[model samples]
Target: MTYFNDFDINENIKKAIKEMGFEEPSPIQEKAIPEILSGRDLIGQAQTGTGKTAAFGIPLINQITTAPHVQTIILTPTRELAIQVSGELQKLSKYMKIRTLPIYGGQSIGHQIRALKQGVQIVIGTPGRIQDHLRRKTLRLDKVRAVVLDEADEMLDMGFIDDIENILKQVNTDRKTLLFSATMPPAIRKLSRRYMNSPVTVSINKSEVTAPSIDQVYFKVLERNKQESLCRILDSKDPELGIIFCRTKKGVAELTEALQARGYLADGLHGDLTQSQRDAVMKKFRDSSIEFLVATDVAARGIDVNDVSHVINYDIPQDPESYVHRIGRTGRAGKSGEALTLVTPREMKHLRSIEAEIKMAIPSHAVPSIEEVVEKQQQSWKNLITDQLNDDEDLSLFNALTEELLEQYEAKDIVRSLMKLNFSSAIGESDDGYNFGETGGAKGMIRFFINVGRNVNMSPKVLIEEISNAVGIPGKAVGRIDIFENFTFVEVPEDVAPFVYEALRYSRINGARVNLEPAKPRPKRENRPRPARPSR
Candidate 1:
């Protein structure tokens, strides 16, 4: 289908599509929608950012022209995706009086029960949460006319396959079933054979799994310098909108703080935050109030945002499938995007695995030096000046001042002075004032006190690994580890102290309860000469 208007949809659906500014249908939508509207069981294999939501949502909403009732159920792998699908369905049905309710964990069940009592035509939810409602008899699906399994492969990885089967058994067997996944793994194939009745398979091209317009590259850096490398990359690229992926919640928080401290507009999103907080953070990201959004993979599911110029992988994903999902957030629609990944020397094997999975070689690049960063900044400044000059504006009031400045000093000198004044505010001082401390000793480190100590046979190595896993920091960044009778004290770089404190506050060491707090300052100890730490 070249355009949504080419499809035989009612005026209400056309009106909604027009309102949403969707001119032409995507490849998946162009193929899947027609088959679905004709009552065929459909299976769509496409990436996340390929307009898959609207492809299924539009037809599903178009079929719902009756009163509010339980008719359609869309199962997602995560609560975030459930909410996202429900919102899109609601928007697509704006001209038509369709009601949708999203059921998921982390929200009040009482409110959901009340909404169900009032009535809902479509229910979008996670398999676990939906099963909970079914067991409680608060949700019934006997009248469901259609079922959708979105991101079926992800649900399998998350161990929701059993729950999905149970949920499917409750619905009518003659109903329509639509399954969508980025890959057609064996598990997905088996599930389709068991559930779907001769489903029509619609897959986007294999080469289309990742956007061709995206410039994908990786940066090789030492484990301890990941933060510094990310900062330098941002300074050089100067992305208009960017998202940084962290593997852990604590990492997201820490990296967001690090970027903000460096004067970048950034925010963090993770599972630890409440639903309202997640919503607020996403709203800011969508509205362009925040330039950088650091998030974990699970928390970022179902997030569809255009205008994202870059996606930075602060940590490599667990698998290549996940890499596709992360980079898909950018280069959406027909626009270009850039994806950069930071890899430690030890993680090169994992990088190679990702490349094999994607069936493409991601070239490695050296980290930008200070001189190169300075040159890029100067070019950016020149581009900014050129854009300002090209923009239409009345400059009559500044003509007199320009003439007076030209007479008082050389024009080149005057221009140079103006450039210095304007550019200084954009690029701050170099990172020469920060101290990273010694790797194995407590030179410029902050001591954190923990409850579990010598009684539990806790060693420095174990403590280091625990802290690194909990906070998503490299073990090399951790300093000395000292243990006492019932308490332990560990040293971390001064910059990472806050992140470690916050992560350890809710974490345990060696399966023992822990209460972590900042330790009192200790006297310096004599040690051999070591390299001075870098400045912030």
Candidate 2:
């Protein structure tokens, strides 16, 4: 029942927040904003998507005056987070004429320097780039009144702790410091202890911190088959509005292209997009014009859209807490929503850790079949036809066309032709019913069988990586890998198979020596006839 008014934020900021349609302050924002505004150093413990950006941004903006230049700097772990935080701060400060710039790699440093020279009030940057600017003397923090270490644990995990420490040292010694992280690891605690000045510690309850409405599920899939399997599942579930989480911005773009090629209304969100472009994509998604959003975790943060039906993990998150945050996009406001995770064999331990932390075992679900997709499409078409028939308007035009066609062709024939056209167009032409061979890689490829299978928890991803690394072949050069319990079958270019065999002869994965040999065709079991004696 608590709301944003309790924070007593500036009227302009509050108005902007209201226009953004946020009524309640998330627990972390509620507890941390006031303390941050009181000129006290604070440590906020909260998870992603908890409105942490506004929590820190509101107070930071309130303290800055139009006269002071670049008086606040926020350090984030990834470039995506840097851009996202900067944009959110800009939105919250729209009425105040406060200038904020996001500085990170993959962008023109010369442009950042120009922006810095223009006397921006706040700089939000990734640690490495911030350090680069500091070393170049393009960034001057002498007048910085406050510094925020956002996602402190992520910075530590990413080995940016040293960069953060260096940046902190460069800022004004008397500056107020605020640290926010999802978890309080000892490393984060130590960093805070060294930098913060008797900071007030505010912790939102862990259960309340995570979205409880998300129903999480994981599918054990081989790495090579993941792309195909994911396409199938997407076709099966057909979420109305959803986001697929990938690990990197490159991955986001790659997946977005792949999804769009498959005829899905999907778009990528990442640090690479300009502010206007990102705004356009988010607007389309929120308005239901875009069905799927492919994004990295950092880029997806601070997204507060409702009615997302699903959140999918295209790759397993590196940490358990990230799994929690990715799926939290769906199943909100007492509505049931689904979260699907694709996990490789080696990542089962990571999945178990997530289950232990969340105290829920995500049920194992079968990958949807191509036939099932066809069936769903057919049903949907039938429903559409039925809905049209129920409409009160006259159908004289359609009826006349039907009658003319019926005069030349029997009703069954016309119907069959129409059905064929509809189904063929929907499913597209099949490439000779071959699974892996359609790409022309199956011709000269020799299949190798390894003695690891379902029993040993072998997955396609691990098998492909091991084979690729051991044989010095690129991952894409290796073909299909089928994992069965106690064994796996991998395809390699026939020319490279000999080299692969020699290379992996002594390789061991998970403490078991990998046995490799030519893959044998599976034997088909013969059905036996009932004995004649039974009739007697």
**Top-lDDT structure, candidate number:** 1
Task: Give a tens-digit lDDT track for model 2, residues 1-536.
Answer: 67877776678888888877788887788889889888999999877666788999988887888974889999987665787798889889988978999998878899999988988999999888998999999889988999999888878877898898888988999799999888889989898889889999998764564447666777755555566678777778888888899999988998899778767899999978886788789889989998999998767765766699999999888877787767766766456788899875445556777778876677777666667768878778788778987999888868878879989999989877887775553454333111332222367887777776766557777777776655445789888876755677678887556556655655677667777777655435734223223235
Local error of candidate 1 at residue 491 (angstroms): 38
Put down candidate 1 lDDT per residue, 1-536, tens digits, no spaces.
Answer: 39999988878989988898889998889989999999999999988888899988888888875666788999998877887788888888888877899999888999999999888999999998899999999999988999999999889878999999999999987799999998788999999999999999998863475758788999866565578778888888889999899999999989998888777899999989887899899899999999999999878877778799999999998888788888988998678999999876446667878888777888767677776777888876788899989989988989999999989999899988898677653444455222424333366677777877777778888888876754456998898776776777788877556556655665667788788877755536745324234469
User: Scored by Cα lDDT, where does model 1 land?
Assistant: 0.83
Give the alpha-carbon lDDT of every model. Answer: 0.83, 0.78
Query: What is candidate 2's CA lDDT for residue 77?
Result: 79
Residue 258's lDDT within candidate 1 is 82
TM-score of each: 0.67, 0.63
Query: Pairs clashing in candidate 1?
Result: 431-535, 431-536, 432-535, 433-535, 433-536, 434-535, 434-536
